[model samples]
Target: MEKISNFLEQSRMKDYILKTKLGESSLSTVWKAEHRTTGEAVALKQIPVAKLTRHLKNCLECEITFLSSVNHPNIIRLLNFFECEGCIILVMEFCAGGNLASYIRRRGRVQECMAKRFMQQLGAGLKVLKQNHVIHRDLKPENILLSCSECNPILKIADFGLSRILLPDESAETVCGSPLYMAPEILQFQRYDEKVDMWSVGAILFELLNGYPPFHGRTSVQLLQNIKESTSLPFSHLVLPELHPECMDLCSRLLSINPDDRLSFEDFYQHNFLRT
Candidate 1:
């Protein structure tokens, strides 16, 4: 506790002034803050120490450890972190345009050109994560944010609490992630590698074009069953008719039931859909 107090004192000297509460979840609360000296805005995530279970503690440590070593334009940057008596504070790069989930909710489906641009940026970020041997277990619209509210805003990937650093031959079997965007392998409790993230990318791309997930169910059991039994994307004719055939093809490949058949990040970037 004494060490925590000292750390808080030192952090206060750095002059981060909290402005407004940005968002909150069961484990943490995020705030929009600014550096008093430089006036640079940042997102501050506060995780209460008292409420952390063993699993949550591990997640917190994993997120901080991995984020500190990564530096990429399309990935959210963790600038600083502090541990206080009651909570852990992480100062992260602020994205004024907010997350993709809200952006989609407001505009419904995004235009093809804009969706392509965002997908390209997201793919770039995933490439970096792959090079670093990290797998983002949870990849969804809510985990993606815009750098600014503009016609061609830079898309940044955020939320690494469920991420894991894998070895050359390692695969994760943890059935953890948002059910809506989870890969079929993950939902079926099968061993999955970084390819799971690609499946999620497909789900996001589908939602960006259609305003809803490819698979849906009234209950978790039903959702899992739907994902396991699903063989193809149930594309709406109204939306599909307007989108390029190449785009639809790419989505289908990415969301393939078999992980081995799913498009690799490199292939996705080079796909005709993105090229067009």
Candidate 2:
């Protein structure tokens, strides 16, 4: 932690301007910044030291270690890290095209082919992380970023705040992920692994095709019950009813209530919707 802070102090990047605020969650604020020396833009994620618990501080340190090991075109790049006042600032490549969540909110429903393209890009990014034995506990649309142009949205998975690096023989038993897209096993607090991410991908795909998730309710308990007991809507019932049955069937298998039954990443990649 001290080394990271010292390294940022020595960089001496000059003439920086705060372009705008990119995003804000409960614990951190993301800002868009420009580098005067290299004439490049970057995303600056700032987390206050005062606001961090010991656990959160450890998580932040782990995040730095994880980012250092990750490098992929479809994954957001962590350019640098620095300390300002009492805050830890993580400098990253700015995704000007915004996040997938914002895009979905703006356009209601995306075209089937376009949704598949984004999922393929997401899967490709996940493949890299999986190869490194990392799992992004949170895989919702909000964490998936886009490139600068709307014409070609380069999907890059962002926000490693909830991610974990698994050891070769280890399994995660803690339940931590977005409830809306969480796998049933996670809700039940059962031991789980990388397959939870596959369930989330299936949930995102369902929303992309049907314009909403399979489970909807006014309360958290209701939502949990829905997810635990819901049956997937067939592809034929989607807005684009012409979508191949194989595509919908794959979605069903991916979103299965039993995590043991969910599609593995390799099988998901081989599905006709993605392979086609």
Candidate 3:
């Protein structure tokens, strides 16, 4: 709470009281705060406008614009935002269950039914992105949040730092996203379409089912090489017999190195893995 009082006191945004630091990066800090009148919990992300790079500023604008326009249970909501001094603050809903990464870390490999439910929710969120012509260049377990610690919690997609709008036929040439979850086309510096997001979803699904990422490397080149060489998903023997065939099929399709063959968001959302 004391960490953010100076900033809050300086601004007109004195209606909220910062309680704890949620996260921090070189460019911004996130704090969990409570509204003074309503006692509602919220996440406040503070970024210094003076220190923002061109790319970061663009990402901030995109995040604000995209979040403000859409409303979905699987997508993080923007409560309010205000600028003060040299900083830009974004107010968002506070997710109590932390992120999917922490969820997976604590539980290890999840049950088949649970993994399927997660994928379905992620797909539902992607539908919103597709409708808005947006590409969430960064999609990983760390960016996906849980609404609660209940037996069945809602998954909300968060962090639009690397997102951008891309039309149906358009492709993005940017080389960004986490190495482990990034598509081979992106790592190879090839222009890619929305299918790149599917690759990320595949990596998330792989981690959920097997408790590890599909590929690992010291560098991007090595990772690309690993993906190129692997003829099929390297499922652990322990789970090989336990996992459903449809689940494995969907995961393999999403991880396809060739974007041309990768499942589109439409096909992915309606995949048999989710249907069954």
Candidate 4:
């Protein structure tokens, strides 16, 4: 805590003006800044460098390291990094369009064509990460960011606090993610692989069609049970012919209860829905 406090105290705008606070959570704070020289705007995330438990601090460092190494059009770009006092500040490209979760809430369920576009871009981003041996444990609407007003609202995966780089033989044991989006394997608390991410994509696809998550309850336990048992009854079966069969097919394969039975990237890419 002392390190973070000192870092905050030392923070000074190098070439930008602090406009306003965008958001805040327990771990970090976000600010909108306008570059003084370039006249460009960006989002600045300030992470406490000190006083964090060693585990959390290592996590933050991991995110920084990963972001620095990886780059893709659909992924959020890290613009700058600096240390102030005991705080570490990351300046990132700002996406004025906001996250997909808030976007969906305001616009309601998106069109099948539009949702497919999002899924393709999201898959592209995931492909890059998986090729690098990084598995994003949290894959949900909130993490996807829009690119611009005119271009396809590209999905930029962000927030890597729960993410870990998987070793060749290493399998993840820790089960952590939003309950509604958790894969069957994850809820079981068993050692799992990258397939958990596929399950999340499936859940997101289902929500895109139905305007709400497939699983729901007043509490966490109920939500988990819903995921465990609700796999066979798809949201598509309820909507039926009203919804495109192609879209429904994609969702069904994505939401498969068994990770081994889920669609592979090759299969997903080959789907006619995306080709169209």
By lDDT, who's the top model here?
3
lDDT of 3 by residue, 65-117 (tens): 99999899999999888886668888899999999999999998898899999
Angstrom error at residue 85, model 1: 2.6
Could you give the candidate ranking by lDDT, starting with the highest? Answer: 3, 1, 2, 4
Whole-model lDDT values for every prediction:
0.86, 0.80, 0.90, 0.78
Question: What is the C-alpha lDDT profile of model 2 across 1-276, one tens digit per residue?
Answer: 988765666553334567899889888999888987777888889888899877677667767887887788999999878777677888899998898887888777777888788878988998888887888888888888899656788999898887777866678887777888887788777888889899899988877776676676676577778776655553434475656677677788888877678898889888888888
Return the candidate ranking by TM-score, descending.
Answer: 3, 1, 2, 4
Kindly report which residue pairs in candidate 3 clash with one another: none
For candidate 3, the C-alpha RMSD (Å) to the true structure equals 3.6
**Model 1, stretches more than 4 Å misplaced?**
1-14, 228-231
1 versus 4: better TM-score goes to: 1
Instruction: Give the higher-TM-score candidate: 2 or 3.
Output: 3
> Which model, 2 or 4, shows the larger lDDT?
2
Q: List the candidate 4 regions with Cα displacement exceeding 4 Å.
A: 1-12, 149-151, 231-239
> Across residues 159-232, which tens digit of lDDT does each residue of candidate 4 receive?
77677788666788887777788887888778988878888898888888777787787777777677677636
> What is the number of residue pairs that collide in model 4?
3
